[model samples]
Target chain A: MSETAQRGGAIPPNSATPLVSLRDIRLTFGSHQALRGVDLDVMPGECLALLGDNAAGKSTLSKVISGTYIPDSGTITVQGEEVRFTGPNDARSRNIEMVFQDLALCDHIDVVGNLFLGRELNKGPFLDQKAMLARAQEMLEALEIRIPRLTARVEKLSGGQRQAIAIARAASFQPKVLIMDEPTSALAVAEVEAVLSLINRVKAKGVGVVLITHRLQDVFRVCDRAAIMYEGTKVAERMIADTNLEEIVNLITGGH
Target chain B: MANYTERAKQSHAVEWLNDNAQVLSIALFFIACMGFFWALTDTFMTTGNLLNVVRQGAPVLIVAVAMTFVIMTAGIDLAVGSIVALINALAAILMANGFDWVTTSVMMLAAGAVVGLAQGWFISFQGIAAFIVTLAGMSILRGIALYITEGYSIPIKDQAGFFWLGRGTLAGIPVPAILAVLVAIIGFIIMRNTRYGRQVVAVGSNLEAARRVGMPARWIVCSVYMMSGIACAIAGLLIAARLGSGSSNAAVGFEMQVIAAVVLGGTSLMGGRGSILGTALGALTILIIGNGLILMHVSPFLTQIVTGVIILLAVWMNTRLFGAGFKLGKKG
Candidate 1:
């Protein structure tokens, strides 16, 4: 294990506290245990890939962090202070935004509209279309994303373009802890590369990102640390520098 | 630069056509209907007849404007006709009971909003489907209207101002028509320019997306119904004022006309995509068809059949033809 893995990334001289710290989080649904005593810490300026098989509780744990599901018993600490989220809005207010696998874009709305979905800029009672348009262009350009027209409805866009817009929407707001579930699932090779680079940029901005994905190659590209989940419990945590593909794959398959 | 376009994409012109297809198709249909009426009837092209068409169609237009908002959010308000009938009867009864026209109008409008709020509550907050809740509202409200009027048309004895709302002309235009036009303009502004309008489209397009983004999704859904309610009050007041009487039968089969107008204007039944401009054109087209058919000495029952056929045809064009890119001369 690397020094960062041994101390759980807590010994860094400049940044000591994790952005989001979870301890003994457990949740159940009927007869199935979705999560069991999972302890994890998301440090600032780091990307953590959460790896698991199909019923490995990756989504459940991400939802718990995003406030979609309230855990039955757990301690959720943001900035070292214990807190419980009542809903996604509560999590959002604390600057913890999640990009779900579905990329919740309103298909009928225009590109600018989806980018500013929840928080729209308005002048008087009307939507500040000019301001929003200008700002939208800037946000997309900053991320090196290009949509032919900002006013075109999102349904008219391609899947990769749609995925890019969804990420830009969540990433542009400067969230402290950004959680993305399978964001690159719909992307092609070049699009995936763009996303990885974008993740690196977001990490540099001191935003702790929780990436839940099936593509393990993407894990090596963007993730600095990884936590593997088996059944409902987190089997092991590995620092990216000290871990390889085989070790993480074994950890996910319950090999110690 | 990272090109996000991984596959073949549409050109800007094709995309624009796809977005505006419904409105354009409806506009063309409106013009075609007008020309057909003009070529057929000598009297239909006259200003007097046109003004009369607008005047009579005003009440339906008012309700249709609100219906656009309701349907834009992928929700339906089936009880609008009942609301109009209830308000129509209630307005006359209140006037007969020594209430002034202004006060009665205010009270009637409030009642309309309350009815809408109640229905909205059941549909949105209570998680009931909008169709079921409003269907029940339609029955219950019409029943209330029948119960109150007791199968009688209550007359308004002496209210010239109230009478003017329905029967009066403003600058050679009917007051009702003027009011309806104003409401349509306001509805256009709201749906196109306002933040609330964007939210309505957002909620209708993908409700889960809207909620996830922290929008007041339930409140927005509920408020559109409230708008429908307030519009019903206006339409009711106009009818009562015009006829100088109110009864349970004031707006019989009125819902059919208003809904047909909305759907004909290219507002999708599935919600999320609608245009107030399209609705206004739709209301006018329906008005022209009825007026033109009557001028041609056709049976009154034929108007209903024609209107039903038009609705079906228009919706078919909307979903089947316009669902794809609206290429003017290009073939697949």
Candidate 2:
């Protein structure tokens, strides 16, 4: 009876289908295939964790979704319309921003400058410093980032502060779906907590998040659903309540 | 608690000292040189000698300004000396061929810009190292200069304004000095105020990060080399006017002097950090040394060794002062 009800529960509230739906995605780099027939559905406002071991297709999927790579043969539909990304800039223009593993920040630039880098606030030809700073301050306050100086160079910032700024930059763009690849992997324990809070804040703002991480604790704590990829294929998709850490690890490491 | 506060105070003082070390070291060097000159010669401090220093240092200073940008990107342009010779020959050749002075001057400047762009494109876009490309450029440009004039010095006639640039003084300031100062001011403004300037610094610091952020790194690199070429051409024309003769041998070994001035000014050859004011001061320092040596009747042969030693010391001081501020490959 529970199984029947589980299958009949309005298909987990994807009433308008997924904001991003990837079907049978494949990626090959030279002799190695990074991703193979990977299918994913990310509904709006939900945090989905893509968990996998080293060399898994988690990074490739994130890259493809972020428009860094073109899948060899696949159908990616955004809001029920088939979409193909030519590059990262194209993906960003489509309101799909990815927080790369390296964060891709210009350290010499200040927090406000980094936040509004390529897409700066401008009044005609001049950069609108007042408006851009105000917007950056708002994003920081909303995320609860306790930076001592917003004008300080990113190079002088603490690790946590840098991470917060990176997230804020992506968040300020207000993408429909934010893809964060190992956002907290290099962060300390306190930094991790701050990042978790920031992610929740983004999710609350109605932006779907695809968190690609190796840590199981983050997956269970922050994510609604878990998708485990092994080798090049995603082998399992489970609700947070229905799975345990050990089982997920087994699925990632083993074929069955 | 008192110990912690005292330690903190000591560290803060040290940091302050480190930050101001560049200016402080230069001041000390300046004072010491002045004292030595006063002891050795009476004419060294005169206005006439000062004017002489300015006249002699102007061309080198102009070339050094452009060199600062190239060195700031951790790149080198070995073809600069040869390019200067080529420009000198071209200016004279155009004048001899019945071209008007204005058109000939414009043509020479354009030639420099084109040559710079060509070399820059090869280095920045073709994925070739700067040293290799500029090395080849140096030989190629020297060959072109030789081929054009057949190793002969040609006197530039019918171009009085061009001649005046090297020999004329304007309101107590020499023309070349004025030109150098103006170029330095423009360089300072661009590096400090403009977005494109910041991108150049960023690319020098890290190309991968710059590219990821959509900076036109190749363009910036290319533009810098082009500017360097234009500078060399200007300096070449100055040398030609000063001698009233354009030759393939004019401005020979000038690249070394330009690099020396930049390094003395605290502009590291490793790139990502430079200051135009520092470069100007560095050029002045070179002029002072050259003048002081001449007043003391030091042989030109020994002066080269002394200059080399002084440059090394200046770079050592720069490293000691700015070592903590710049991080090398800390990202990876």
Candidate 3:
């Protein structure tokens, strides 16, 4: 791990603390334990790839971080300060934004509407459409995203366009920590490239990123550190340069 | 490098047509209905007959405007007709007991909102399906009206101010029609331009998505029902003022007519898509068909059959013919 740590470019410097640290997080549902005693740390300007096979508790752990699940026992420290989140909103108030696997977009609304969603710009009692449109344009432009029609409803957009909008919405919120679950699962090759570049851009801003995906290639392309989970517990944490794809695959398939 | 095809850019006129296909189809259908009626009967084209149609259609138009919001949220309020009857009966009873029209009207409107809020609570907070909750409301509300009035039509007498609301003309236009128009205009602006309107559409489009985004999804869902209730109250008041009587039987089958108008106006029953302009045109269409059939000496009972068939036909055309890829053959 120490040998490959040097190759993990953009890793947070020693002076910077971990953006989020989790200790002994445990969660259960009826007879099943979704997460059991998981510990993890994410540093600023680093991309952490969460890897596991089906039913490996990867989603459960992400939900715990995103405040969709209340762990039975855990201490979550953000910027070295311990805190508890009651719901997703609480997590959001702390500038932790999650791009859900399903994208969580309103299809009937236009692109600007989806981007703004709950936080609409208002003038008096009405929505400031012009201001919102201008800001939405700026947001996409800043991210190097091209959406021809900002007023077009999201339902009409292609899969890649939809994913881009979802990421842009999360990225534009000034999030200190960004979590994405399988964001490029349904994208074409070029679209996947777009998203990978987007992740790099976000990471460049010193934001901690947690990417949960099944695509190992994506992990190699962007993630600096990889965590592998087995059953309901994390089994291995490896610096991306320290571990080969075979080693990570073995960790996921229980061969290690 | 992946060869990505540039997205096809549609001309502004084509984009506008695509966005408003449902509304345009309904508009064309409305115009066709008007032209057919005018060709059939000279009386149908007369200003007096048109004004009468507006007056008679005013109550349905008011309720239908509110129903557009309810339907846009992918929810239905079947109890609106029952609520109207209840308010109609309650208003007469209040006035008969020496309560002035102003006090009685205010009380009825409040009653309507309370009833709507109660039903909304069950549907939103309690996780009950809107259809089932409002179905129960339909029966219970109408039953309450019948029980209170005992199947009698209570007379409302000698309130000139109140009578003006239903019977008086403003610049030769019926007051009820004017009120309905104002309500429609307000509904149109709110749905098209306001933050609350956008929230309502967001909630309807995807409830879970709206909630995850921090919208007060439950509150938005509940408030639309309250709006429907208020509209029903206004409608009931208009009916009472027009007939000078209130009865449990008032506006029977009104929910069906209102829903038909909304659906015919291109509002989707599945939620997330609706148009207030389409709803107004739809209400006018129904009223015109009924009036024209009568003018052409069609049987009164046959009018119901025709209206029902037209609603079905109009919705069928909306979903099948004019839904998508519909073009006028000539490009702008």
Off by over 4 Å in 3: A1-14, B1-5, B324-332
Q: Which candidate achieves the best lDDT against the true structure? A: 3
Q: Would you estimate the TM-scores of all the predictions?
A: 0.95, 0.88, 0.96
Model 3 / residue A136 / CA error / Å: 0.2
- A177-231 in candidate 2: lDDT tens per residue? 9999999999888788889888888998889899999888988888988888888
Question: lDDT per model, in order?
Answer: 0.90, 0.80, 0.91
What is the lDDT, from 0 to 100, of the residue A225 in candidate 2? 87
The positional error of residue A27 in candidate 1, measured at the CA in angstroms, is 2.2
- The RMSD of every model to the true structure, in order and in angstroms, is 2.8, 5.1, 3.3
TM-score of chain B taken alone, every candidate: 0.95, 0.90, 0.96
Poorest stretch of ten by lDDT in candidate 2 chain A:
A2-11
lDDT of 2 at A66: 85
- Fraction of native Cα contacts reproduced by each candidate: 0.79, 0.14, 0.56
* Clash pairs for candidate 3: none
Question: Compared with the true structure, what per-residue lDDT tens digits does model 3 show for residues B1-332?
Answer: 32224567778988888788899989999999999999988899999999999998999999999999999899999999999999999999999999999999999999999999999999999989999999999999999999999999999988889989999999999999999999999999999899899988998898889999899999999999999999999999999999998999999999998999999999988888889999999999888998999999999999999999998999998898766445543454
- What lDDT score is found at residue B142 in candidate 2? 91
Give the candidate number with the greatest TM-score: 3
What is the DockQ for all candidates, taken in turn? 0.62, 0.25, 0.55
